[model samples]
Target chain A: MLSLDHARTILDVVLKTGTEKGFKPLAAVVLDARGAMKAFAAQDGTSLKRGEIARGKADGALAMGLGSRAIAKMAAERPAFVAAATHAVGGSLVPVPGGVLILQGGEVVGAVGVSGDLSDNDEICAVAGIEAAGLKADTGA
Target chain B: MLSLDHARTILDVVLKTGTEKGFKPLAAVVLDARGAMKAFAAQDGTSLKRGEIARGKADGALAMGLGSRAIAKMAAERPAFVAAATHAVGGSLVPVPGGVLILQGGEVVGAVGVSGDLSDNDEICAVAGIEAAGLKADTGA
Candidate 1:
């Protein structure tokens, strides 16, 4: 089980990295192995919508057992399928580039999602945050 | 405005307090003033349903600008109105005792909800968590 401290570490690192990089204010979410939220934060200037977007990306990654970047590619290839899936799930799944799975000892432990910046930048922050937490970022399915 | 750090702090305190009290594993959700989820967690043994219930309770409290305990009383008094209201909101409102508003400087900033135990016990945990975060609980209308 991922501890709350570890989740907070991921969130803090993500926000700090975004600040250091001079990216736009961001929102980040950390979810445990069961796809339940463990921690979350939205920088002061982030829009209220950032929280939901970040959570959607993270939940999508966990549900698919793949990084959100991969899901984005799939969505691009089959828009109809992705749309149907999102609707079926009550709009929880978002095909985006900011979600990365957290892996420890070669096992999936949780996920981190960042939003409010460009999707690529958001993904980079999530990867950096996971690495800072001494965990691997599973960006590839 | 409630920051993500504050939400995480509240969630952490609630879980810790529950553990200290030897209560059942719980799921908790924290929502910002706009009713957007800021943080959430389901303890190791908590059922998935706990998360939804917790969120429902919090959403209900926020929607009514009152505590879940008061909403529960209202529901008990007027079942028809409560049912219609819940249905109108797509079932987001739960008239239960686990939701408590978070007040800072005498203003409602957010709310917290806990589930996975008796409703009373869940409310106690939520109140404890809010108080630990240096906020007051508004359980009364």
Candidate 2:
């Protein structure tokens, strides 16, 4: 089970790293299997729009059972997938970064999403969040 | 100025209340100055579709400078306003009770929007959120 405490730890660690690296990031969210929030955080300077972006990424990962990067690649190969998602979710399935699926003992458990920084930075923070939550990041296919 | 801390506090209190009261809720959002998100949360067991409803309520409140309840009334009275909003921000402004404007020291700093519960229940959560954030809950004109 994805614990809220774990989500909070991931958020804290990611935000701390962003601060240390001087990144002006906005919001981060972690969601459990039920598609509900386990943890969520927004930095002081982050904007509201970032909230939507972060959620979109997280939802994509949760829905597709893969990281958002893979989803993006799939979107490229299957544009209809993205189009259908846009219609089905009312423009929530943005093909962006800051989303990662959480794995536990080789099983998918949850997802973490970050926004407010560059895509690379966001991905780094998301990985950091997963690490802080005491989980290993599956960076390889 | 609205702070992410306040937004998080509102969501925490409101969601806690929802769980205690046995209300089904899906999404919640807090908006700061310039109508951006300070924090957002989607609770467990909520449909991913509820996110749009949550953000739409907050956007409606911010756009009209009133609680979503008032916007609901206005929408009933002047349907044009609803159409205008729909055209304005990609139909992101949904006039409903799930939204509450945050008033700090007699000024509007932000708004809160909730979804997945009954409209009345959503309103109640918004009120609780605003109060929890140390802001006044303006439910009416």
Candidate 3:
């Protein structure tokens, strides 16, 4: 189970890393293994849109049991399928680079999503957050 | 203007109220005036569905400028209209009873939604959360 404490820790790390890297203000979301939101936070300067985008990316990664980078690759190869999937999921999925699955003992424990920077930068922040939480991040497909 | 502090306070209140009432573990969502998620948390043992349902209810309330209870009534009266509205909003609307609009100084600041137990109980929790956050619950149509 992803504890609220862990979620907050992850959010803190994500935000701190983004700030240290001079990235844009960011929004981060942590979802438990069951795809339930454990915690969410958006920096003061971040746009409201970043919140939804971050959550969508995290939700997509959780639903597909893969990192958002992998999902993005799949989307690139199968635009039609990705479109259909977005429609099918009521527009919840966002195949992007910022969502990364959190692993513990070789099992998916949760996921973290970050937004408000370049896609790759957002992904790097998520990875940093997950690692800071003492969890493994599955950034690769 | 709903701040992150207010959103987290609201979520805490909702979860605490639900636990005190012996309700099932609840998931709660707080959305800013722009219909952006400000904070979200799902208590341990709650299903992931609760998270989505809570978010959907809050999103619906914000979009329609009405509480979820009012939306539910409207859905009952005009199912087709409600369906069309849901589709129009990309399926974010959930005409359910757990969503309540948050009012501050007679202005819509944000909204709160809870899910887990009976619909009425969920609504009650959301109201408690809003009130605990020193805001008014605008459940009236």
Model 3, C-alpha of A85: deviation from truth (Å) = 8.4
Task: List model 2 lDDT by residue over B20-90, tens digit each.
Answer: 88998557877786777676667655775686688788888888788888888888999996888778867
**Per-residue alpha-carbon lDDT of model 2 for A1-141, expressed as tens digits?**
776557767878888888888888658888787666666677876654777788888888777777888777777899997779767866666566667888899888888888888877888888987987789664223
- Give one digit per residue, the lDDT tens place, for model 1 in B1-141: 887678877888899989998999988999888887777777776764678889999999998888999999999999999899889878988898999999999999999988888989898889888888888998744
What is the TM-score of chain A, computed separately for every candidate?
A: 0.95, 0.90, 0.96
> Which docking band does candidate 1 fall into?
acceptable
- Per-residue lDDT tens digits for candidate 3, residues B85-112, read 9999889888989989999999999899
Whichever of 1 and 2 has more DockQ, that candidate is 1
Better of 1 and 2 by TM-score: 1
TM-score of 1: 0.88
Interface RMSD of predicted model 2: 3.5
- TM-scores for every candidate against the unseen true structure: 0.88, 0.76, 0.81
Ranking by TM-score: 1, 3, 2
Interface RMSD of each: 2.6, 3.5, 1.5
From the highest lDDT down, the ranking of the candidates is 3, 1, 2
Number of clashing pairs per prediction, in order: 0, 2, 0
Would you give the TM-score of chain B in model 1? 0.96
